[model samples]
Target: MAYAADFYIQENIIGYTGDSQNKPTVYFRSGHKFGRITQAYPDSNYQGRSLVREYTDYSISNRPPKGTAEEYYNGEVRHCSRYPFIPVDDNDSLKAVLAIAIASYPYKKPIYSK
Candidate 1:
């Protein structure tokens, strides 16, 4: 069963003081009873530059680290250093889950008409 959770998005916008070009780095984090999951989108721009999104799903049985926010966030950063994709018993199930997650996000369509 799906559990209740809170999702957060952290964006880092980069631009020169006088430049109009803005580059964004987006990071997503969701926490649930089972565990927490995080995704990072680097060098995201209007051109849709492909970035390696990282994900981690900590099991409920795992123990939480004992430390402050710095340590916790640092550990998460390290955990994301590994590949994000998790192997599921059924490929179809994995695809379905991923599809739902992606659909939940408020993705903007390309402004081709304008």
Candidate 2:
């Protein structure tokens, strides 16, 4: 099955905003079983000053369950929502990618180094 972490990564990239450079937003979506990465951009906006926002609709598994902050910090549950940045930047989306990459040992792949 597609790892919940992968979905989390894709969602973060889709919603990422790189300062205000107007750089093209990038995202990665992995298949449930094969674990492949797909890139897509539903919509992007750059209002100058390096302010950018990307939007997409995706769901992830391995996320921390909703609860009070105390519950999460205490290690009561794995709250994915609490950790938005996993593989990449500490944004809501990158967290999933980070987790999946680490768990799958995809770091060996040269794609990330580039």
Candidate 3:
């Protein structure tokens, strides 16, 4: 499975959800730096550090009991619901993808520089 963090870099997507549709908007850039992924309401005015905190919170599993924030964000990414950059044909496929991402997170090997 691809590392969950790599999804951003692989897709090269950057934007917040659209105000009305909640559909994601794409503002393309040549490259991207993978960071945290989390939910931010369309109306929310999320600052840089706030976004970072959300990402960290999601990463550490400090989200709602209903589900982890990271999972929800990943679902959005997986489905291309909020963001159209990632393509997924159905919810089942997204779920399977999420399961793999979650399963892979804890066991991911660390990269060490030579």
Candidate 4:
């Protein structure tokens, strides 16, 4: 189950990630249940646990302090965080989720296209 879930996540990150004004955002299972990390606080670090929240009504202008937009997949709300990735288990050994978060994060732009 873990491997399948991880593969699914990876496939989504690669094939289904969306862009808003060229800003990258990740969608879980091709739905609006997605995340677009705007800015990381000065002390923000993906390597550490941070307070994460969920929001039903979200917008850039009318923003809240924490939490990410709710993502629904397989008939459940997919858990999300301010951190880069959602851990599949207690030990996120490979940090695959972090890689997805980085890919979807809007901090840097790609230099060239292949």
- For this target, which candidate reaches the highest lDDT against the unseen true structure? 4
Q: What's the distance in Å from true for residue 54, model 1?
A: 14
TM-score of 2: 0.16
lDDT of 1 by residue, 85-114 (tens): 222233333333333323243332222113
Please write out the lDDT profile of model 2 over residues 1-114, one tens digit for every residue. Answer: 323343434343322222212332222343322122212223222111111112232333333353211112222432232223222444554445333332333222233323
Ten residues in a row with the worst lDDT in model 4? Answer: 105-114
Worst 10 residues of 2 by lDDT: 44-53
Total clashing pairs for each candidate: 0, 20, 1, 1
Q: Rate the local accuracy (lDDT) of all candidates.
A: 0.25, 0.29, 0.27, 0.32
* Residue 103 alpha-carbon offset, candidate 4, angstroms: 6.1
TM-score against native, each model: 0.21, 0.16, 0.20, 0.20
Ten residues in sequence with the least summed lDDT for candidate 1: 11-20
Winner of 2 and 4 under TM-score: 4
